[model samples]
Target: MVVGGDAAKEYVAGFAAGVATVIVGHPFDTIKVKLQTHNTKTQVKEYKNAIHCTSQILRSEGVKGLYRGASSSFIGMAFESSLIFGIYSQAKQLLQGETESIKPQLQVIIPSAAFGGALISFILCPAELVKCRMQVQGRDSANSNYVRYAGPLDCALNTMKSEGVKGIFRGGFTTLLRESIGNATFFSTYEMSRHYMHLQLNSNSSARSQQSKILSDVGIGIISGGLAGMAFWTAVLPLDVAKTLIQTAPDPNSSRDPFRTLGSIYSRVGLKGCYAGLGPTLARAFPANAVAIVTWEGAAKLLGVKRD
Candidate 1:
C-alpha cells in the first residue's frame, strides 16, 4: 500500500520544482520552441539564431513576451512534475519492495522509470499542447494559419469543443516515446551519478554513507539532473521536433500522417530539421531539469521522505 504522507511530500516537492523550472527556463524553452517551428521560407522569417531570437522577443514584446506561455507551462508543468515524481517514487517503492538486497540496481530502475514515464505522458499531452500552441502564436507571419489561444483553459475548451477530447492528445505518441526513453535514462543517470559523486568527493566510506545519504548536495543533484537532461535530449530530440510539429499544427482537423511528416522533414532538411532547436534546448535542459530534480529530491527529504 502507498503511504499517504510520502506521496504528498513527493507531489508538493514536484510542484515547487515545476514552478521553479518554468520561472528559470521558460524563456529558453520559448526560444527553443520558436526555433523548432521556424520557417525557412524566403519571404518572412523572424529569428536567425538563439541570440537573435532573444533579441527579437526582447525588442518586440519586451521581457513579458519571452514568458508568453508561462501560465500554461507553469500550471501544466506543476501537475506534470508532481505526477511524474510522486508516481515514480511510489512505483519505485512498489518495485523495490522490502528487498533491501536488491539495491535498486539498473535492472529494476530502468523499467520502473519507463513505467513512470509512460504514465506521466497522459498529463504531459494537454500541457504540451497548450504550451506549444501558445508559444508559437504571434510569432507566425500575418498570412500564417496558426490560431491564437487566450490562455490554457480557453485552449483546452476550444480544442475539446472542435475536435473532442481526443484532440488533446494530438502529439501523445511522440510525448510517450520521448518521455519513456528520456526518463529511463534519467533515473539511471541520477543513481550512477550520485554514486560517482560520492566516490569523487567523499574519500571515507563512513563519511560518504552519512553525508551522501540522499540528495545531500544541491550541486550533485544539479549535475546529475543536467547530465540526465543531456542524455534525454541527445537521444530523443528528433522525435521531440516531430512531436512539437504535430502539437503546434495550424488546422486541428487537417490531419497529416505523423510518420510521413517525420520522414518528409528528415528527407527535406536532412538531420538538421530534426535537430532544429537543439542548442537552446540543451542549454535549457541542463539548468531547468537540474533545478527540478534537485528541488524534488530536496523537498521530499525536508518533508520526511526516508533515504534509500
Candidate 2:
C-alpha cells in the first residue's frame, strides 16, 4: 500500500534531485534558449551562431550570465520534477499493483506520465516565464526603449507592477499544454524502454546481474529521454512556438488570441519556424533527462523503494 508518507518522501527526494540537476544544467539551458530564440537582426554578430554565441556570452556576461534565471529554474524544477516523479511513481504503483508480475506496458505507463505531466505544468509555467524573460534580456531590439529588468526578482516585480499578478502567468495555459504532453511522452517512453531492457536481460539468465541492471537502466534512460524529447517537440512544436511568442512578445498590449498568434507565426516563418528551438531542446534534454532519471532511480533505491 502506498501511503501519503511514502509519497511525501518521494517528493522530497525528487526535489533534491531536481535542485542538483538545475545547478548543473541550467547554464546550458540558458544558452540553448538564447541560441534558439536569438533576435532576427541583432548586430551582436557574436551570437550569430552557437559557438560564437556561447563564447560571446562568456566573454561579455561572464559565468553569471550563463546561469541567469537559474534561481527561478531551481524554484520551478523543485515543484515540477518533485511532483512529476512523486506522482509518476505513485501512479505506476497504483496501476501496476503491488506485484512482481507487473509488466511495463503503455497501458500502465502512459496514463501515469500524462497525470504527472499535468501536475508538473502548473509548477513549470511561472518559473518558465521568468526563465524566458531573463534569457532574452539585453537582446531585445536596440531601437526600442524597453525597461531592462535586473534579474528574476525585478522581472517578477515589474511584471506585477505593469500587468498585475496575472501578468506573471502569461502563456501559462500554453505552457501547461506543452509540458503535459511533452512530459507524458517523456516518462512513457522511458518506462517502456526500461521495461523492455529489463525483460530482455532477464530472458537470458546469464545476462541478469546487478551490473547489467544498472547498464540497462542508464542505456534505456538515455535513449528514452532523447527519443521522448524528439517526440515531444515534434508533436507540439506549434504550441511551443506559440507559447514562446506569447511569453516573449515584445509588446505586452498585443493581441492575446492564440489562434491569431499561431497563424501569425506560421505565416511569418512558415512551418519550419515553429521548430526553431528543437536543436537546443534536444541537446539539453539528452543530458538533463539522463541525469534526472538516473538520479531519481538511484534515490528511490537508496530510500529502499521496491517494485512489488
Top candidate, metric TM-score: 1
Off-target runs (Cα >4 Å) in candidate 1 are 1-5, 39-46, 101-104, 139-141, 204-216, 254-257
Give per-model TM-scores: 0.89, 0.85
Best by lDDT: 1
lDDT of 2 by residue, 1-308 (tens): 24434777788768876886687678767766675455322323225555666787788788888887888999998778888888888887788774545456677777887888877776787788788888777544355434567788988898888888878888877877777777678766776666776677677765467887778777776666556656766677667667766776667887556567677766765655565555666666667777777777677667866544
lDDT of 1 by residue, 72-136 (tens): 88887888888877777787777877666423378767887888889888888888888888888
Over 4 Å off, model 2: 1-5, 39-47, 96-101, 139-146, 205-216, 257-259
Q: Which residue pairs overlap in candidate 1's backbone?
A: none
